[model samples]
Target: MADPIDPSGLGRLLSETMSALGQFGGGPQDDVVPPEGVGEAADGMVRAAVAPPGRVTALALDPRVMRMASESLAEEITRAVNGALADLQEKAAGAVPGQVDLGGLGDQLRRIQEDAGRQLTKFTDSLIEAQDRLARQGGK
Candidate 1:
């Protein structure tokens, strides 16, 4: 039989790739996030915000087994979801002005919303599955 595939390399590659992507998006996040209840904060700023619609594609990941790969797969799915959501926000914003007619607008909006909802549900489910897989791997 052929030699077993080395999962360590795959895991390392994935982890590095994830780190690069995260840095590319919004730099690294602060290690500690401030509590929300502290009243006024700073001005609005953009950061890599993972969106919901990409939950499945982001999460539909399976890589050779290594602890690093497991973590990377999870992170990628999360990042992908955020990226998907960002795109949706842009689309929504752009379409808002074009949808002037309230009735027609409502119909169009409803369709879009329903489609997004379906997709989001699918992605979320996939993410959950991925997480379960990760948990199982960890248990082993």
Candidate 2:
């Protein structure tokens, strides 16, 4: 039989994703204004987007505790993305979606989270690039 998935795996994903985001984001002290902040926020958002949930399964946290942390982290990521969007919209007068529109974004995020298998594509591409560079060096 296939390995059982923890019922709380999604929660774990959220928590671990948040933890990774926190590291990527630094802290309030790291914040800058306008475009730089937007760039940093977008990077954080993509890191979460690109994170694979299977890794969450491998974490050693207590399932019950991690589940709660996951919920909070998911909320934090949503807020962080929306907050960045809002700030950028104010500065750029562009069409950043409102926080209320996060439902649509969240739907996309859920799909990404569920289809974590595709993460291997990134690794495969990276390996190919490394091999190409080595070939260019004539096996140096």
Q: Model 1 TM-score?
A: 0.28
Model 2, 85: alpha-carbon shift in Å?
A: 0.3
Compute each candidate's TM-score over C-alphas. Answer: 0.28, 0.22
lDDT (10s digit) by residue, model 1, range 10-107 = 45545655554444344454763421111111111112233333233222322332334556545554454555566656754553323235565456
lDDT of each: 0.45, 0.45
State the lDDT at 100 in candidate 1.
38
How many clashing residue pairs, candidate 1? 5
Residue pairs with backbone overlap in model 1: 50-82, 51-81, 51-82, 56-123, 58-77
User: Model 2 scores what on Cα lDDT?
Assistant: 0.45
Per-residue alpha-carbon lDDT of candidate 2 for residues 1-140, written as tens digits (9 for 90 to 100): 22444445556667656654444444344554333223112224322111111121111223343345566655655555455455544554442223343565466556657644444444456677778889999966
